[model samples]
Target: MTDPVDLFVIGGGVNGAGIARDAAGRGLSVILCEKDDLAQGTSSRSGKLVHGGLRYLEYYEFRLVREALIEREVLLNAAPHIIWPMRFVLPHSPDDRPAWLVRLGLFFYDHLGGRRKLPGTRTLDLRRDPEGAPIKDAYSKGFEYSDCWVDDARLVVLNAVDAAARGAEVLTRTACVSARRDGGLWRIEMRDGATGAMRTVTARALVNAAGPWVTDIIGRVTGTNSARNVRLVKGSHLIVQKFWDGPQAYLVQNTDKRVIFINPYEDDKALIGTTDIPYDGAPEKVVADEDEIAYLLAAVNRYFKVQLRSDDVLESFSGVRPLYDDGQGNPSAVTRDYVFDLDTGGGGEGGDGAPLLNVFGGKITTFRKLAEHALDRLGGRFPAMGNAWTSGAPLPGGDLPGADVPAFLNTLRTEYPWLPRKLAGHYTRLYGTRTREILGNAADLGDLGRQFGPLLFEAEAKFLRRTEWATCAEDVLRRRTKHALHMTKAERAAFADWFDNAAASHRREAAS
Candidate 1:
C-alpha cells in the first residue's frame, strides 16, 4: 500500500521548501521531493539579497517593492545567522540618472515601506568618503542605502529542516515520475535516482513549486496544462577576490542603465553580478558566457578605480529565472513578481477534483510571504488548518537572545574556546545554535573526525547529512557550506572521493 500524506510538494527550491515548512507546521502530513540536491536550482544562484528591487520601483510596482522591503527585516530577524544588514553604495553618474532623481527615488525607497530595523538612506560625498575612494574621479556623489544579504542555499536547507522538524518527509535525489488523482487524493510514483527503486505514495493535495521546471512538471510530469507560461530569463554572477576594504557593497550604474552589485563575500572575496538575457536553453545548461562575463566586468570597471579584467574572475555561475510570461520585450524589463495558476482541472484522466497550484516568478526576499499566500490560496479546502505563524516565529536557531548576533557569538565562543575564532565565526554565521550540536562533546580540533579543508571538518559534513539532508560532496561544500571555494582542486577531489565512500557506507548501514 502506498503511504499517504496531506501535502505533496514537488521541487526543493526555496519556494517548495518554504511551502513544505509552512504546510508541515500547520499540521499537514507533507512529503517534499527533489530531483537533485536542494537549492541546486535558481534558489542557490540568486544575487543573495533580501531587499526590495530598487529598479522595480521605477516600474510603479510599489506594492511589490513595499512588501519586499518589509520582508527584508522579517527575514533578517527570523534568520539572523544567515541574513544580515548590508549598506549599498550607489555612485552617482550624471549622464545616466540625475542626482535629484536618484535622491527622489531613494527618498521614496526609504519611506515607501515599513522601515523598522534597517537604517535609512544617506548621502555620500564621493571625494571625501572612503566608499568613493574606489570609484573613478569622474563620479562626485553617491547614496548609501540599507538592505539584507542572505545565504540563499542555507535558507532552503533551513526551511527543509524546519519542515522535517515539523514532521514533513523530505526526499532528496528522488524524482516524481507521475502523479494521478485517485478520488480526492493524489497517487504519486517517485523514482530514487541512486538505487533505481520506486515508491508509491498518496497525497491529498499537490504543490507545483518546481521553479524552472514548473511548466515541465505541470505538462510533462503531471499530464496537465496551464494557461500561464513561464518565461525563462537567465541571470549570471561572478566571484572574485576582495579588492577593496570595508564591508559595504557597491551598486554601480552602467552606461546601458543596468546596475551591477559588488558585494563582500566569504570573508575575503567579492561577489559581482548579474546580466538579464533571454534564455531558451535548459536550466542545467545555464552558465556564465564570455560575453556575459565581459559585460559584468565592464559594468564594474566603469565606476571603480580598479580596472576589472576577465582574468580576475575566480568563478562564475548562472541561473534561469522562471518568470511568468507577461509579453515583456526586454528580459531585464520582465517582472520579478510571482503569480499563482491554480487549476482545479479534472484530475489526471480520472476526473477527480484535485487542484494543482503552479508557482511562477518569485524572489528569495519574500519566500515566507509567498508560502503563506500559496497556503491561503488553498485554505478554503482546509479550513481546519492553523492561521499564519511564520512572521513571529524564528527560523531554526535564529532565536538568539534579543536577536543580537554578537552576544550569541560571544556565548558560542565561550562554550568552544578551543575552536579558532575564524572557524567559530563561520560556524556561528552558518549554523547558529546548531553549532553546538555539530560540536557535541568535542574538546578540541582533533575531535572533529577528519580535516578535509580549511574550516571543513567531517563532523560538520556528517551533521549536514544527518540533519540538513546533504547527500553528496558538492551538496556539502557548495550548498550546505562554501568550503569548496576555499579548498584546492586536489582537496576538493579528495573530499569528493571520501564523501562518496562515506555516503555508500551510510546507505549500507541504513539498509541493514
Candidate 2:
C-alpha cells in the first residue's frame, strides 16, 4: 500500500484516460489502471468519427447533438492530424426519409454547436456530382455534410500520455481487483495480467469509467450498486478494399431506418458498419457474426452501384456500446448521451465519505466535455484541484500551424527530402509534430531499420515499445497503428514472431 492519492481511476478506455488527464493536469495525484491495452475495448472499436449524431434530431436529442457538434470543432483544433474534417455523402431515398427532414437536420447540425472551421451542408445532384458516381441511379439527390474522422485508439493513448506527462501513474495490463472505502480514502488492489504481481494504492475518491463492464466494477470490484444501468448494444463493422475513388465517405440509410457509414479507411479500404443488436454475452467474447456482416453488406449494396460479396470482407469487428438505459425499447433509440452517478457514501447529495463517481454512457466526440463535467462533480472533494485547462490546450503532438496537415507535410518533406511521400504522410498522420521522435537522424529508408510491412519499420516499432507501452504485436499492429490491415496474413505472422522474440530477448537482457 502507498499514501493516499487524490483519485484512483478504473478502466483505461477514453473516458478513464480523459478523466485521468484532466485530474493530473489539475495537480491531483492519479492512478489509471487498465486490464488490457489502453483502448483494447469499445474505445478502439468505435465508428472512428467525431460526429454530432445528425440522425438524433428525429429522436428530439437537440442538447446532445449540439454539445457533440461543439466538441467536433474542439477535437478538430486539438488534434488536427488524426482528427480532420470529412464530408459524408448521404444518398437520399424517398422511402427512407423526407428531403426536408434531412435538410433541417443538416441545418441544425451546422449551427447547433457553432460551426466555424468546417464547411456547411450542400445539396448534390447525384447525376452530376462526382461524389455520387458510385451511387445507384435510383438516388438522384443527396446531402453532403461535415464531420471529423479520428484515430480512436490513438486518441485514448494520447490522453494517457498527456496524463502521465503531468505526473499520473498509468498501469496497462493491470486490473483493479478491489476498491473499498476505508477511513477517508478508497483502497485499491490491482493484479498484473502478465506476471500476476499484486500492488495496492489508496485514493480519496474512485471513478468507475469501465464502459461496458461498469456495472461489474460497481457490484463485483467495488461491492456497491447504483440505480442506473447500461444497455449492451452490439455495433459491428466490416473492412473491405476501398471501392470508391474519392476521399469522401458514404452514409447510407437502410430500409430499417438505421444508417450505416462506409468510410474510407487505411487509405485503400472502406470501414462499413454497424449493426445495433441487443447483446447479452461477455464483452470480451463479442465478435462480428455472419448475420451482422450480411446486414452491413446489404446496407452497402442498397445504395452503392458496386455489389459487395461476403468474400470481399477483409476483416470484421464488433463493439458493445454500453448506452445509458432510459427505458427505450429500440437499441438505436437508447441515448448516446452520458450520465454520472455519484454515490456520496450514503451521506446524501452534498454529504460524503469517500465519493465514488460512476460514469455510465459516453461517445467519442464528447469525451473531453465528459471529463470536464466529471471533474466538476468532484470539485468539492478536491478543493485544491486546478481549473479546467484542456479546452484550449493541444494534445501531445496536436500543436500544428493553424491545424494544417498539407502545410505540415510540405515542411516535413522539405526537411527530410529522402523520405518517401507515403511514409512521411503516415508518420505525420499518426505522430503529428512528434514525427521526429521516430525519424531521429535517419537519412534514408535503410536508417529506418527492417521493414515489417509497407508502412511498418524497425525504428517505429522500437519507438512505440519504448514510449507507448506497446507489449504485444497486436498492440503495435491493430491498435497503435493499422498496419495489420495492409499486411498479408503471412507477413503479419512474421512480424508477430519477430515482436515476441525481440520482447523476450529484452526481458532476458534486463534479467542478466
Pick by lDDT: which candidate is best? 2
Local distance difference test, candidate 2: 0.94
Query: Best candidate, TM-score-wise?
Result: 2
Task: Give a tens-digit lDDT track for model 2, residues 93-113.
Answer: 999899999998899889999
Model 2 off-target regions past 4 Å? none
Clashing pairs in 2: none
- Give TM-scores for every candidate, taking all chains together and pairing residue i with residue i: 0.98, 0.99
Worst 10 residues of 2 by lDDT: 344-353
Clashes per candidate, residues 3 or more apart or on different chains? 0, 0
lDDT by residue for model 1 (1-512), tens: 55678889999999999999999999888999999999999999999999899988777888989999988889988999999999999999989988898889888888877798889999999999998888889998999999999999999999999999999999999999999877777889999998889999988789999999999899888898888988998899999999888999999888888889999999899999889999898898899999999999999988888888998999999999998888889887778889998767654323347777889988898889999999998776577888888998889888888888899888988988898988888988999888899999999999998998989988998999889878889999999889999999999999999989998999899899
How many pairs of residues in model 1 come into backbone collision? 0
